[model samples]
Target chain A: MTAAPAAVEARDLSKEFDGRTVVDRITFAVPRGTTFGLLGANGAGKTTTILMLLGLLRPDRGEAQVLGHDMERDRFRALQRANFSSPYVSLPHRLTARQNLTVYGRLYGVSEVRRRIEDIARELRIEDLLDRPVGKMSAGQKTRVGIGKVLLNDPEVLFLDEPTASLSPESAAWLRSFLGAYRDRTRATIVLASHNMPEVEAMCDSVAFLQQGRLLEQGAPRDLIRRHGKQTLEEVFLEVAEGDTGRQQGPGDLA
Target chain B: MKASLGRIGAMMTRYMYLYQVSPIRILELVYWPTFNMLIWGFMQEYLRSATHPAVFAASYLIAAVLLWDVLFRSQLGLTLGFVEEMWARNLGHLAVSPLRPLEFVGALIATSLIRTLVAVGGAGFLATLFFGFNALELGFGLALFFLNLVIMGWGVGLAVCAILLRYGLAAEALAWGALFVLQPLCGVFYPVSVLPDWLEPVARALPATHVFEGMRTVVQDGRLDIDLLAQAFLLNIPYALAGLAAFLGAYAVARRRGLLMGTGE
Candidate 1:
């Protein structure tokens, strides 16, 4: 059988702000229905790369594509089938979770929006919080509601930035399990950008490490750990972050 | 581009939800317009009592106050629509949604119309109740004057949004104060002829100047000056176009700078 087209792809995508290059010519692709993780330190351009892929930021060079549509030329088509969630981004604080979801559902053109919102609220275990204003909810609760916003349309491709940040251990674990189950059921492709290594290790089918806006390494978590001769992904991360100048390494070129 | 009415309606729904939930917000829409009407209405009475009673009709000043709000409230309505998203840090979410920028702007304009109607309606109602002056007495001139004023207000409102997007919240003060710069120049409370010889030309250049001038003609002469009305509509075409171009240009710059992802109060 023929392979399905990549759900998300970036070809030498670059972006610069005020003469400073924040995202260099980075390139990668995610196979259909798999989770791809973008791991980087703060100011490492992970967010910028994701923004370009989502067509939220214009690239200085190259292109990003989602669901076989060029993001720059035809992002609206891809966006209609995709959704994104980030902890840094927020829903309107004064609106209730249900209100926010209803708005989003309608924007996504989801039919029977009320029923969809109820289903999402139940699945996210936010049924009770749905009626409460977003500002009154705790951070963890807000995060789940944010995820519900992403799931409203049952996006074919999902972009998640730090999906589990600031959650308690139990809450984070629950969220991961829920996400994994959702992927299994829907086979939706997810691209995650996070500083949480273990979460990346547990969630991503393949991961890319970016240093100073450049792709430094990319592979399966186990393969990367074994190649670097480290016991865990965190140890390998510390070495990549501290032991080498970011410009020295190329993807899979470690001696 | 295929714009989605559903997306546009969704954005309008969010604003309505915010409007309905907050008592202070609902009260705020009518408060300032009503307050301005009462003060000016009372002051107009005092001027008639103290000065030449025949110099200006008693309804003239009250009508000016009511019409001026069409400009003020419409401008305020549009800017507040955008500023609310910034205050909530919801711009990033909006940026990624299927909702197009033009569609979002359309939603802002629709809400501004609602806000202008509510505020001006409240103030007009009070003028008739407290003072025996009804703004409706201006007849068809009132509708034409309102249309011209709203368009002029929207032109300024879009320019203010461009300023906010380019400079972030640090430039937020301009949103509330931008139209005030035009107040004196636009003859909101006086005729353009009352201005200094040097400033008269500058005042006449503004669309609101023509609008207010037309309003005075309707009230004082009880006839519409077709020239002023026509000038107001003609001036608005370019003014509104310039505002739209500035806003779209600023949006492109913000996208390049990646400001849409992080812009917030």
Candidate 2:
């Protein structure tokens, strides 16, 4: 079998708002068929970077490519194969789950749109909620529907913005397994943004720590723990965030 | 070009379909047009009972009452469309896509046309049933009158939508108030003969005043005064073009400012 290229790649990507650089020049790569968890506190610019990757925001300098298409130019082809989901943004409350899914399916130009809708609805276990109005559904129900919409197109790169924010522990567990299975089946690259270190350690192939729009460190969970000489990933997160740990080498130093 | 057009078509179809399916939006569509029709219909009754009235008043009344929404409802249609996007926080979804500003504007413009047709058809049907006057008074003059009303109405509506996008839902009232100014100034409900001299010049500047006045003059009198028609055309074309520029300009500004927080929070 042929080796796959990276799902997402950035080279010295930067973004500025009114001359204030919010996203500093940073470079990273996530291989195809792997999940990259972005860890950061509030206002850490994780959201901004995700938005830029999705082509919702343009960088002032540098470049990013998503799903092998340039983020700045040729983004339509990139966006066409990609889909994003977040709890903060909602679907039309006036429509039933089926109707909402159908609209997005048509937007994606997905073939067998109805079948895809049905399949996702069942996968999300939202079969009963299909007929009910979106606004009338509970938060958990909405989240489920939101996730279902993202899957409708079988996106090549699925970006999740705080997917489990309001979800119960049980629901979160169920969702993690569901997402894992889906990724295994489709080889879809995922970018998960969350503040929870434990979830990132469990779900991600590699976790990238972010703070103040800068990537502090990136590595596999076990490797990070070994490097930090910590008992747990949470301790490793705190030490690195607090500037007590990280950087085994100095300026001009290489491993 | 073909792909962009296809995407535009897809977006337009989904919006229109969703509009028809949404009960509240459809209700607003019906409520606003009929609400104004009732007021004008009453005014028509009062004019009929008054002293020797302007001849061909019935045609003027029916046409004005039926087409007034071209000014308010079409613009309001676009405002409401954006408002829906804002409320659902789906603006991000659209913003991230490879959607061009042109395609977005095309979708909005097409919606305005659909909304205008619905308003015109609904009000015209009501007027014909209630006043026994025709909405479709097709003649050489009537065609030009229609050209003036629909085209210019859409342009004004687009300009209003620009304002709505910059502001928010609380400002949707401007779309309604737009009619208040245009109806009187345009002489849609009355003859320009009655408007005061000072106000007449200002009205002359508003293309709607010329549109409704010209429509009334033609459909009622069966005479197309080339000067009046030309005045209407001259005024409406620039405003419509200005409206188009304003729409694209507003979109650009929104993009640059990053004010597109769909939640409006």
Candidate 3:
């Protein structure tokens, strides 16, 4: 049987800052049309890995490719097919949401920009907030608008960094559902970096656990839990994050 | 190329939206230029009666004020354009998009040109209304001088942006102060020869020095000094190229060091 195509691939991807390694020689592959979660604690090189994949930060050693394009040599081509959304970053505050969306839509070279914006606005249920300045919007409203902005390109791959970081549980659940539906409809690959264990388990098809710039364990949530002899993914996460690897069992090694 | 243009227009539209939404932003653009023009106009009126200069004193000072603003506004426009993205925490968003670094630079230059035009245009009008002096009298020479000064400003501004990118917000003060450091050396209101002998060569190396000298020549001799204009362009080419190199170099360092993230205050 043929293997699935990789939507994103990194080989010995590494980076260091000020003589300190922030991203060790990490390697991973995310298949197309799947949601792959990058689970890690704070300062675990999650954002750094995402930036390298997006070509915003170059890897000090090794290489990455997104949608078959080399990130370093042909980043623009890959970027054209990819979009990123994060609640931490913001759109320009002085401009209205509509104006902000229009600018990003135009930047992505979207045809019929206004119509596309209206369609996304409807889909995201952010029509009322469209004309309001971004600075005045509630956190939930801004998160929705940010999602709308990323969707303007109809990107083939989406990178999300702590997308639900500041969101309430209800809003976070809604966003997760929306992302799942969007992924199914578009068959777009998604790379999600998050600390929410439940959200990652519910939304991600596969997960990679990172600790201190290294990939400690990676597999489906159930597979990881079973291999660790843990009852839940959260416990598995803690076990892996806390260097309890002696308790970890390989696949099919479960007693 | 077409995509580049679209992206550039998109950036310009972003700033256009900012200017449209806030009257204060638009007012800030014109305020300093107009105020400086008025003060210089009054000073010129006094100099006109007190000095027995061959050229009309009002003509010289008004031209100085108007052209000097062309330089200042161009530099500030480019610096502030980058700063605005930093303020909004939008640099990360922009970097991950399909926008190339070259396209980003193009947009900044295009925005700076538009800003320089508006600010200087407003001040030029005020100069005419208040002092009855027409800066356009410099004729076609005005375009060459303006182009030279704007290029020089871009060179300086790009360097300042490079410093900011490498060092983050702590180096932001250089954006406002760097250009002024060149002001006295550029001989904006005087001649290069008027400077100290040791400083004369340093002054001559600056393209704006030749521009202001060319302006003075046009005001006094009523003829364009093609030699000065040629010298200004020659100096500008290398300076602008160096600025571009510095910015690109700094960007590489920033990316390698993971400095691009969380750059905003």
Over the stretch A171-238, how does candidate 1's per-residue lDDT look in tens digits? 99999999888888999999999999999999999999888898878889999999999998888888
Candidate 3 Cα outliers beyond 4 Å, as residue runs: A244-255, B53-58
Tens digits of per-residue lDDT, candidate 2, B1-265, equal 7757765775676577576566577776777678677777877777777845665355566577665666666666665566666666666767765566667767776776787777767877777787776656546765666667766766776677677667755566776666565666778777777988888888888766766776766676666677887888898879889988987787656654555544343
* DockQ rank order: 3, 1, 2
Comparing candidate 1 with candidate 3, which one achieves the higher DockQ?
Answer: 3
- Stretches off by above 4 angstroms in model 1 are A1-3, A241-243, A246-255, B1-3
Docking class of 2: acceptable
- The DockQ figures for the candidates are 0.78, 0.39, 0.80
The DockQ-based CAPRI class assigned to model 3 is medium
Docking class of 1: medium
Q: Residues A142-188, candidate 3, lDDT per residue (tens digit)?
A: 88899999899999999998888877888889889999999999999
lDDT of 3: 0.89
